[model samples]
Target chain A: MAADWIVFWVCAPISIGSAIAMLLQRNAVHAALFLIVNLFTVAVLYLVLGAPFLFAVQIIVYAGAIMVLFLFVIMLLGVDREERLVERLRGQRTAAILLGLGVVGEVVFAIRAGVGFSTRAPAGFGAANGGGNPQALGRLLFRAYFLPFEVTSILLMVAAVAAMVLARRRERPVASAERRAQEPIEPSEPSEPSEPREEEPVG
Target chain B: MLGQFLSHPPVELGPIGPELVLAGAGVLVLLGGALVRRRQPRALLLASLAGLTGAAVVSVSLWRWRGHATVLGGMVQADRFAVVARLILLGVAALALVLGHHYFERLGEERPEFYPLVLFTTLGMTLITAAADLILVFLALEILSLSLYVLTALSRRLAAVEGSMKYFLLGAFSSAFFLYGVAMAYGATGSTHLSTIARSLAGQTGNQALALAAVALLVIGFGFKVAAVPFHMWTPDVYQGAPTAVTAYMSAATKVAAFAAFLRVLMTSFQPLTWDWTPIVWGLAVATMIVGSVLAIAQTDIKRMLAYSSIAHAGFVLVGVSAATQEGIQSALFYLLAYAATILGAFGVVMLASGRGEEHTSLGSYAGLCRRSPLLAGLMSLFLLSMAGIPPTAGFIAKVNVFRAAVDAGHWGVALVGVLASVVAAFFYIRVMVLMYMQEPLEDVEPDPSIVPRLAVAVPALLTLLFGVFPGLVLGLLERASVLRW
Candidate 1:
């Protein structure tokens, strides 16, 4: 009850506030720090759910490992120097507008359908198809779905490491474009600085 | 079937030995890299190599296993076919590790995560070959792709990021298609397990239209992965943009794994739907081969050229698949093994010859490569020749095997088209050879003096020639493994 109360009162507003602040912060370092606070609140929320393993993992993996990576990436890429807000992905606005339109269209379809989801299974598909989501998922998730379950764990591990690799390279002694860009340029295929700042519009 | 599955052991550990070993190894590498005060990332690389070798050994030991063909509640196929595919994937991963190690060490970088990412990718690819359930197949695909997308961007070049973005977006779209197909399949057959689906298909139960829709969508998903044309808009850019090591590794491994799943899903679950899907494969094969070769000839970037060449190669493999015969599977296996070796070595040379920052990958830069470093040029020549399907090289025999399989299955038109495409491909391969020997060397470009990468490249180069000269070396084993037991 104490944990629940603290989560609702202390962590809730703080988490929401930090998330908003994280989005607004111009400085990458400050933004990253705000994210860490938000992550901590998420771990507390997980603790309140009685998922101790998930709570520990949320803190250690997200707040500890991933946040450190964010900071390192921010510091190493000198992104903090580019304090001016520049949309890294140029077409994001267009993408968002299109996505918004799709959502509106979905809402219209849902209205026409009377019910968004069918309570009764489609004809000839019933308990034969494992009637409900949770029932089927529970059957598959723990028991006979051994390969997929184990594979998912490995998939998560790979995804985490890959995220690190994609975002977390230090400024080189390593063979990177930043160092390559410093050297005399090649006539063709100039390796750019690879930072997510104002990119030229090309597919 | 459900009763039988339940009657067996709930979690059979014996059939999943390689996966268990791979999981342990992946964790070991991940944890070792994290905990140890790192010296050379070479130790991590060595650890990964040991893990891959152990997995391969376990797979080999399982060859011709006498017990049940399905294990883990029929979620995985415990067959020689899976064993062979797993072995090939494991071997290529080991080579890719060495190449990755050399690529980084030469650059004076110590990325402890690289080896783990590679190990995990291998784990995914091997799992894909054995996965007998649609859910497992999708999971394995995601695992390999997520790792690959990250690995592509690991070089952190602007081009690398761009390529990663294209790959990630398109890959997500494909994954959705695949998942939707799985849903459709469940609707049609009331199960996501391949064996149950097969039984449903054979019995002509469940909705036929829904089942057909599932097949088409699943094909589109696998087609994207294998870089089959019409769905292959990302190939050239991603190939040219990714770090050469990633391109080299995934160009070979991804095709093999995707095609393995493709063949298994089609032959196992949709065998009764044979008449429905072969024409689709026929169209894909024709379009992929023709477009892949024709577009490749117009490429200037070496990586992009190799990209299209790989696309053409996929068509050749699909020709085998289109045959819908056991011989076709055998030939496809042989084709994958040879292509893996040839592409790994070709890209290894590109990695070595890319000068200091690994930037000199253009075809023009490769001019006078022979004069500057004869060893790299020779290795490059051997690999290119193999890729061109030239005689006395592995590619020649692989092409012959697949084309012959197509012909035997009465796919004469596809077999003929494949031959024509191979001929067109040879022009570009020889064009590279001509550039290396006939043209003057670029003064600014300097190949790295990395001995280990050179050795790694040499190993595959030797194998390429050996397999070429004697097709029986690996083909003998493949012949035994092609008999799918599901």
Candidate 2:
């Protein structure tokens, strides 16, 4: 247990440091690579917490598929022209302070209330929500939470449709003549030839 | 007496037939869509037809099995209340689907995916009203929310993306609160089943603290879904930005599902803790009503105005919920059906009148609509009047029942505030009517003939009048179906 604690203590800082560094990095591609490393470290943290299922999911889902998709979009779009620096305007600092204070107050209140928490090392996940075993999770998911699971699939379908709609260009392009027709007409000034048009002699 | 007969257990499969039909229909639609994707148009048409048929079949089944009963291993127990709510959800989904057929066609987006999504979402709503467990409630909530997020952003337009982003972020955040609350409650009571939890926590230590937190969090989460005060920021943007057809579906269907779930959570799981939670709810109800109606009056954008009106109606429904009685639950169910019909009609009018791409939701665009299209204007006015809770409209009857429930519950302050808010709400509904009838035609005024919006307008308008003239038709059904087990 002491050894485990030592490993956790060592890894935690590295994980958090890498995450912050990844966010602060200027080079877009480098930041993404760092994010991959940071995500893997978080997966390790989940493993330390004895949640192997969550650990695997974290690595495979958050680090692998979702991030890859993110990177693909970012690379495909090419971030150079689109990255705009944001400036904090006046009174924004005050607003942030107030929000921070509210958060602090909430945390303090929770702490003061002494909400007994059970972070005790679990015998297994199954004991959590009436047998948190994966099989139980599956049963609960299919039998009790079946509707939400189905709805999620529909959401995915909608996402697919949105992607298709967003990606697909219109088949018909507007003709130049139509474009010109749609343009508002401006009154023409009587042709003032600045350097009187060079006289073309018929002779 | 009917419940006792059902409880006799020898032969009592009469009730819960609607839920079974919906479940059957959902499976059919999903499988059918998967099998025939290559024949896109036909598949899409078939999927929608299946959804409509399923909804109709389920609604009819519910009508036949009006007496209350539980089934399917106690996962779903339906009385008149659940039946009526499910029926409303089905009806709304049907109208929304009709509008969707035209909407997608006009937009040249004939994805069969829309019908399956709508079918599954409606199925989720039905399950929500029938949910007998805490886990089931949360699951149903997510099911509805997930579908709506997609539906809210269905348009693939910039506004849709923006609106959906706001909705998703806020919605996901609220869901976390709900989950946390559930976790707390589970920890406190060692059960996720509402009835079991109630029994376990009846005299348990720290039960008040845990139950209060759970109820509060659930309220906040459900409030976001229903467009109640403070959590209503997403309503206008999402409603205005989503495809009008999708918006109509969401407005009617989402509200019904959320209230059903909310009422279930409050009345079932927290019944013992009501005295601890009722005052807070009383405050939220009054504030939601006053804020929703009053703010609506100041909006110039038609979509935004309707969004505010939806919030106001949510408040009215909350009054019924806060009553914490069998009558209150029944009234809430009836009110949801009434509000769904009226709001669907209003959006149907907007969708019908809207140009292709739906860039004309501004109030000014509706000026002199009566002169251009008398039938459309007259229908729109009927919807608007109903929304304002005017007589001979379903909305009025819904509000009266809710108000009676509140008065019965001895929340006279809330009732008075509701009445005042109704008066304030009338101004905006009337303003829309005035714009349609009295104002001169704007320079760019033109009718875009689309079959989708027209049908959308027709069904809800006809139902509004039908339900309005015969209030007992739905209310009586509600009374017969209402189950009062807590």
Query: lDDT of candidate 1 vs native?
Result: 0.86
DockQ of 2: 0.09
| Candidate 2 interface RMSD to the true structure | 6.4
Candidate 2 Cα misplacement greater than 4 A, ranges: A1-203, B1-43, B59-75, B107-112, B448-456
> What is the per-residue lDDT of model 1 for residues B312-411, given as tens digits with 9 covering 90 to 100?
9999999999989999999999999999999989988898888755578788998999988999999999999998898899899999999999889888
Kindly report, for each predicted structure in the order presented, the TM-score of its chain A compared with the true chain A. 0.49, 0.66
Candidates in order have lDDT scores of 0.86, 0.75
Best by DockQ: 1
Model 2 chain B worst lDDT window (10 residues)? B4-13
Candidate 1: pairs in clash? none
lDDT of 2 by residue, B1-486 (tens): 555323423323444455456555556665665575343655565566665666666556655554544444355566556766777788788778887877777666545557767876787787788777766677767767776777776666888889888888999998898888888788777777677667766766446677778778878888888888878889989988888888888988899988888887777777788887788778788888999988888888898899889998998988988888878887888888888888888887787776666878889999999887788899889989888889898888888998999899998988899899999999999988988888997847566675556766877788788878898776776776655575
Task: Compute the lDDT of residue B146 as modeled in candidate 1.
Answer: 92
